[model samples]
Target: MNLKTAWIWGLVSAVLAAGALAAPAASAETLRICSDPDNLPYSKAEGAEHGLYVDLANLVAQKLGAQPRYVWWLSMNQRKALRNTILAGKCDAYFALPADKDYGTRGMKRTQAFLDVAYAVVAPPSFSFSRLADLKGKRIGVGFASTPQIVLAAQGGYTTVTYRTDAEILAALDKGEIDVAFMWGPAAGYDNLTRYHGRWRVTPVAGEHMDHQVAVAVPAKDAALLARIDAALTELRPQITALADKYGFPQGQPVAVGMAQVQAGPADVALVPTAAGGTPYGQPSPYRMMAVAAADPAAAGRELFNSTCSHCHSPNGASPIRARDLRRLKGKYGDDWLKEAKQTIEEGRPDAGMPTWGGTLKEDQINDILAFFKTIQNN
Candidate 1:
């Protein structure tokens, strides 16, 4: 069977509920790339409608003389989708992923980077700043739980107005809702292009871990095509750059006050965990950035629960993993439920793919997750 057909047999039923699409028809000339249907600036559901990654994918496909086709997979929990979709053979290419070893869990192979993006400032033209201190006392916009929000919070001067989406933060900036927005460069750039016709200013932030290398990723099992992609991307860098400009995505190293960085070449890098957690190249999880000064423990707990744990354990609605059903847990335990939950979480059942988060999360954070869980239990 061709690679696409292999997906049907490999995926567990849980992924289908996450809205994994059936493999569409593919001739030898079609390039089926895995993409999140709702993610903007990177990809989306409709026929290559918009997003930098979708556009970039089409560009590469055209260069390869192949038509681009999407294998839609919701990436809210990318770790799940990576296992159920890309690794399962549902798609051949994943346009943009962090160039780092810890990313993609399975050493998913990647090609040379077409762009390097980071949290950047989006403000009106003539906006200038030398460092984080320059924007002090200004009303700033940041995606809740994002790097900028974390950094600015740590620096302690700006009045932060948090938004859920990068696009929302930019729209808030455009409407005079905030003085500046520190958000993902590509999304802010896309909005500036499509929404404002390229009128907004996007300046990359400088600091350790602020800038991340972005590269095209493919399944690790496939090396023959990976070589071709690497060669094509290197040769197509000029065009890829122009394509980025057309979409309003930041293309090169922003001047130190804005861009340019020396880093190791293309590899898988992990996206930060955002407040809401799972936007690729956005952030990884709220727990990972726990030092960012959470104003409300319960609220922070809620965001973490919904963003990460909600993927499998149904703390509310129906869950696909029947064995993980949290809905009926109220009856299954009494006051000692928390203890049982703690033990289960700290020592995950290895045979079932459940990970032990004990080493990964702090005690307060784990309790925060429990706090959020209590609020949603279906008792």
Candidate 2:
């Protein structure tokens, strides 16, 4: 169903459900959540209702014993629209706020942030960039009106190309249209590693406003509603983290991989294609494809790394900070390296500053990522 219609239906559902419970039914407990329709790794209509946030909403509904309804709002131009919905009583809460002071109003209350995310860089393998400074003179892609554009525009120097969504930006990156792209952390990281075969380095930037907390917005008119949400959030935060890990959003730092001697690996390397595959760039593979177009799994891994992961990791599996070189992971990481690599490749280090890949990267592709790690340092 269309997003607009779905919204109206959802609101109706909530009010009707509340009405069915008899007049003045104890404490008012129906919760209507307003969110974006197409914002992925955050909220969506398909699987997991779009990720951790939706799941968290479900958890909250269960905790409150209230009917959970959804309202799909356009992500851009959200503030004014949200205010209208809340004041009109169409929605009890609006999630995905930047937790900014600007959000609160006469009928709006802000809950503590359950998720903290930021803008990050997604680049192809052949390019090299260890730090923010490496973006110099390089062409970078950005989503229009996103934090990345705002920051880079002020920072100056590098050439900036703009797109409207993470899908579009990643497509361009895959096609060599841009040297790098700055995008929403979870969406970018998950899409790249899984759909793109871990073929890109998603690097988070550190600075003012780069990282922001996501909170639930409630109608200021209902103090009780606000407090309930806050309490529910406290109860559900840990579950929320687990949900984020279930997807491929990076929790901590970006994965690092060195390019030195790390050529393409085997053809058996299972690769994941971006969501936008086939229609525009290329068709999405029913079966996984190698990160690189090489026949050798290791060589393909190396090619993929150099074309993508190498941008953030060192040439010989080292990174100054933002990313860690994968090749250095073996001996340096000790006996736990394999298991750690698997976890890092699959779950992503959410607490330790890494995105999970368990949901995104296929087993073979992950094997390729690990194989590439082993090739270096030992060589």
Candidate 3:
């Protein structure tokens, strides 16, 4: 070959070799994020609308000159999901976690909070609420055993109707069965825009556990990575706000709900008491359950049960839904109740909407949950 052609070929070979060597570094630039697959307004795996968290992850990764990669898992139980995903080293980061210092993060480092999550009052556009007294005599719908239910229970002059999910609460509001629905803000707002076509106004409420800031969580060891993520988040703040708006996240000033009254100890402060003689819902108060949990020998088991099973079984396994109510396990299954419960948990009745835990949860963890169940079963 001619010297000129040989030189050109040599240069091309060198460039190709350099590109091949740099391929690994380019691949390493992927930002692996753990997120809920089906959680709307937060994330979804198979959709054009991939939810706020997914979009934000993409944006942040872009800002950091990295590509976004997702490790999708059902996050019905946040703690369990975190344990199985990010904590298990399946991903580099989790899309979001409560930014509260007291919140159990399982030894994960968190970036500065980028968003506010709260219980919101979802009502018709015509409805206006500036203060807690405005809810007096109003039929407020809340999730069973949710913060809103507990808070409203402590206050007088308001009636609360408990529902299983945010969807149900919003449905009741749409049907006019309730004057207002107090529930998770992002969920209510997303449903209002997507399901109800922006028919209702979702106003965020402030108080104690009522509102919290959310941040991205990374492994505690990933200090440098966490710093980079935080820097990217700050640079992308406007874009993040835009994404929240696109997803219909409730923003602006939150109305001060009467948590002070609840904390101050209301006169009829039987937090989880049955609705008798003008009381509201009959769901078990989480605070009361926490106190009971603290004293129980199976406290670890109780925590596991609440973290893993409570989404379907309800808090403390005291579900009002007959099929899900574990308290009646002994009554319904006779002497073989424990066996039935264990088999059901391990094998999962998919037809009945239960997912198999055998593969995901450790045998010891399952046993602990079963031990806790034994304590709650009513003969």
Candidate 4:
């Protein structure tokens, strides 16, 4: 089986195992959860205590005959803080940790995941992305140590601006400083919905690489505690989900990003004709400056499309993965599809893997791409 399929089954099996071992007929006791004080949608020391990890801690505490307590700490060096608090008996659990060895190798154990987080690309409503390639040349806002930065680094060509916090990233996004903001699912979703009043479109990237399972953290020696918490988590899954929704965690159908395409040599396409001079389709089209750029819109489109879009969305309308079919725009998109296509091209359907292009591509270039779409209209 593929790695994704394997991981899915593994999750199912793990859940089942936890369910079989859940604590029975329990009464509540006090359980301390070490969390970051300022981080919202994940943990917060202030009123309501509605973050996913905090809520999950409460649920686990209730299931295990415990009351929940807050232990505020900085998130910069999570491992050291966890060791000092949860491991040292200052707290019983550390809610919300990446379920990987790399996170806290020193002395921490993780329970089966109670939550799954994926990277989201937040953009203007006009943009709709269908794949990673769609993000090329665009400026994206990302958080330090966040998954988006990792993904962006792997896919070069895009200009990624890093920030220390989600608030910084959001500010940049709102100020039109960045075309797209790569953010954590819970924090980004809540802020966008509450602060931005649902003005932004936040889409989650599917697949294992982008998927993050959040689990409870405990001391390394506490295997029994781990197993019991895992069981409690199995019983508290429903409650956990409810809290996630209450705090504005994004839980929607997975959107398919553009498919991965084979690499091709850069095309020498000219930008669409303009009053001053011509430009190229892709960013910094060298040919346009060199006077060797394609003069016709179709040729320019063909060249740029081959070099960039074709990498994921195939030149002949096929792709390595199941991304949008370029040839089928006419069949799939009607008059409404034009607007949809424009939105997809500009903002990108990030949930599906498309990156926003609002600041990256010129209006004329986007029009040229649209015109090219007319030529390859799927039957």
RMSD of each: 13.6, 17.8, 11.6, 18.5
Candidate 3 lDDT, 164-251, residue by residue in tens? 5677778878888789988888888888888999988889988765777878999989999999999999998898889889999999
Each model's lDDT comes to: 0.65, 0.61, 0.74, 0.62
lDDT of 2 by residue, 71-95 (tens): 7665555545565576678887876
Off by over 4 Å in 3: 1-28, 266-379
For model 4, residues 25-89, the per-residue Cα lDDT tens digits are 32334466777776677777676554667666665765665545567776655546666687677
* Shift in Å, residue 313, candidate 2: 32
Preferred candidate (lDDT higher): 3 or 4 = 3
**213-262 in candidate 1: lDDT tens per residue?**
77888888879779888888887888777777777776544634321211
Q: Which stretches of candidate 1 lie over 4 Å from their true place?
A: 1-29, 105-107, 252-277, 284-379
lDDT-wise, the better of 1 and 4 is 1
TM-score of structure candidate 1:
0.62
Model 4 regions more than 4 Å off: 1-28, 137-139, 143-154, 159-165, 206-211, 253-379
TM-scores of all models? 0.62, 0.55, 0.67, 0.55
Clashes of each: 19, 45, 0, 32
Error of 4 at 269 (Å): 26
